[model samples]
Target: MSDPTFSVRPLDEDTWPAFAQLVEANNGVWGGCWCMGFHVRLKGRTAAQNRAEKQERVREGRTHASLVLDGDQCLGWCQFGSPAELPEVKSRRLYEKGLTKLPEWRITCFFTGKGLRRRGVADAALGGALTEIAREGGGLVEGYPEETDDRAVSGSFLHTGPMAAFENHGFTRTRPISPHRWVVTRTVSPT
Candidate 1:
């Protein structure tokens, strides 16, 4: 169960400060990624560049996320966006090979704050994302999560989230995109 003390908010101009604080405190989240890995390639970009680009996207309403908050502080986030909004997904070749049609929304990654792991932050964020999606007139939502039943995986590498997290939100396993990563999906009705 998610922590009841946590509240969810959409990542927008009003909530960018909290989100930026969390990312900044966590060293730009995954070595200065700033949670932009799923949105665009970060090979030549510096951390500052990534931060600027992410902020620009948010300002332009091109980025989407559910920011999990404890009071005014952001604890984590679940990023979801349309295909055009976030096109750089992991295992793209394999995912494309099996793609019959594009989903309306894709949950690309999650970020939990320092000293706050394994405490249901991810679950809360995922739930929040679903609710936000519904408000946007929901449809097919997809997530790429790793199956962790057979092995121990580090939280850092589970940016897409665990399969159990998706299952908890009523998502069903669709197919495997990698050895441990599977494409999971669910349909959320508009709220």
Candidate 2:
């Protein structure tokens, strides 16, 4: 087992490739669709188009982003920015309603490489995200996680971390849009 100590830092050119690779590595679960389900719905677009659009957003997001790492390996990332900065999140029907009522950061998808699971990586990632947001003087950080009994009991989600990891990082349940979806938040600053 690797040491539990790792650093979290702002996403940059040097760090993005590893993040993209990890996302691609999980193509079956997160690939094909461009990670755009929470951002936009491409009614008739081809998979390539979806991938391109998502990659474009990701390229932009890297400059204004947060990521977790164990040495040089990108362990996880939390994609957050202004609603305008993130068209996908801003345009999503489920996320559009209560936005801008406060300044917030969104915790998007998380990915960990094989053999890296069940080792507190998610908690470390979330902690890094919170601290970085605080350093940047951002407002609250938000997360939308699937609510599931099996996850609550076991704290696993294929390669994705479970909701309890967010909760363990001080995120409280704000609302549940459906039995499987929830909105949670942890306010980092009053502004």
lDDT tens digits by residue: candidate 1, 1-191? 78899999999999999999999999999889998998889898899999999999999999999999999999999999999999998998999999998999999999899898878999999999999999999999999998998788988879999888999999999989999999999999999
Ten contiguous residues with the weakest lDDT in model 1: 148-157
The list of candidate 2 runs beyond 4 A from truth reads 1-3, 33-39, 42-65, 87-103, 151-161
Model 1 error, position 82 (Å): 0.1
lDDT of 2 at 187: 82
What TM-score does each of the candidates earn? 0.98, 0.71
